[model samples]
Target: RRYEQRIAAAARRAADRWAGYARTGDQIDLGAEMRHFALDTIWRALTGHPLDQATERELDRIATVVAALPQLPDGEQAGAAVAEDLARIDAVAHAAIAAARRHEDGPDGPGVLRVLLDAAELHPEYTERLIRDELVTLLVAGHETTATTLTWLYLLLDREPGARRWALDAGPEGSPERREAVQALVSETLRLYPSAWILPRHALTEDTLAGHRVEAGTDLLVCPYLTHRDPALWPDPERFDPARFGPGGSRPAHLGGYLPFGLGARACLGTQFALRESVAVLELLLPAFTVRFLDRPAGAVYSITVRPDGPTPVVLAAAV
Candidate 1:
């Protein structure tokens, strides 16, 4: 795949960080490390450049704002609460756009930004503001979701050490079997904590079938996080079992099931990208290191995304 080399490079950079912790026996914040790694991966894919410290520092506010989103007041007041952080995020976005415009063919080659810029030539609607919005969306959605899933994945693996060995034992690194196992791990993680756990939709033209009335103007939310855990759809749904997706695995008997990526036409476009990059990083790190969490959150936090309520600090042990 065109993204294989890029994903590998990003994964290697992340692996190096874990290797450093392994050598020093230092406790690292798993959540922070995963977030950084994910940002770097998506940043490179968007602009063909690695995430530098200065930019990453600014982008860190993305999390702050995202966390506050659920609590913030609606409308104009919402902007006031996160104004400073939004400004910083916007600054970073504009800078990236200008840089991409100047260097359409970046060091790593043309990236998603370049493609957007090229389209602006024929479509005037792709204004600077729109470009910035897209960049910020890709930055937040691309990295944040991936980072959360990975953080959860390792946490789950720590609780179930055998699962890590099971994935590694599926086959050697880069083998199809191993990849499948790694994906299963990610699939399970997402099942438990789906990205954008709750998605809101508006009714343009109301219609209903299950003995319910129709309203032309109404808001509805679809929650994959809830559906993924439905006992009826997923037997023993609370268990973190990846075998549900393995060969000969039995899926929910009901036709409508497992909405991890979501449901219908507007489902996540980056399902494949997210899964691939996740599996890529796991293929490298899972085999190379074992993490012992210094501390685990007492529970999960529900916000723009569902994540561990507290910090995930861990010490890594490199495999012998």
Candidate 2:
């Protein structure tokens, strides 16, 4: 219910902004636009505020910090990397907690923060600090992965006219058929260019992944990009064919090979959320514009998350 209200509000804001750009015929940054969409949605859904001026600046700064860190370093210094992120998470959570406390009198549960605050009342052990940790995790994971996916999706669709046309032909956001098409597009994009290209795991005990024997404590790096592109599973892997995911195309028997979101209990909690968010934004954008990518020799840069090294420029002409 909260998510729906927040999304509806954000959609209104997006439509207004989109209208302004349409009138001016001005080039808009879709990446930045989607970033704002995610933040605004969170603001409305989680915080009960529609992102005040100060909060917007802080969100932008947070995005920058995450982008700068790339990914947490593994090995001996892993502790330090975690500590750094924890500090950032702490700051964001405290800000949110303080804001929620000021407005605790409201009805409708007062958004996600208030929900946590309320939970703390019932569960005596649920402390404010614990609430902060969870909120920090939710915000970072919710924002970064979805934003990266949306940016990459825009870049890929901008390069492929056929995919863009198919997406545009899919009905509006509320249409079930349209939602399925959007999901296929998102799935195919993740297969080709996953936001978290590499997912790391440790062998709890002696085991084997595929044919490789894993000893206890062995660090296992599962490369989704490599596996998703493997000719054994995906034919003509280089091609941008959303049809590859349609009922007809082949899929690997070992679906585990492609891990955009990790597998088992450790997998991303926001997997469903990210998919929904990406599809929603794509459904909105695809019907409105004829997207064309500006020429650039860009490829993925390995970080904590994979992202385009520079701006993925595109021209969004009106689909008239």
Q: Which candidate achieves the best lDDT against the true structure?
A: 1
Tens digits of per-residue lDDT for model 1, 27-57: 8899899999889888888988888999999
Worst 10 residues of 1 by lDDT: 253-262
Supply candidate 1's per-residue lDDT for 188.
86
Which 10 residues in a row give candidate 2 its minimum summed lDDT? Answer: 101-110
Whole-model lDDT for model 2 versus the true structure? 0.71
List, residue by residue over 1-320, the lDDT tens digit for candidate 2. Answer: 33665666666676677766766667666667777877776666677767666666656665656665654455766656566655655676687798787775323247877888888889988988788877776777777777777777777776776787675566655788677777888888888888788888888899977698889999988788888898888788887787666556567778585678878888888777677666666666667656555654377767777877776555556678
Off by over 4 Å in 2: 70-92, 102-109, 170-174, 292-297
lDDT of 1: 0.86
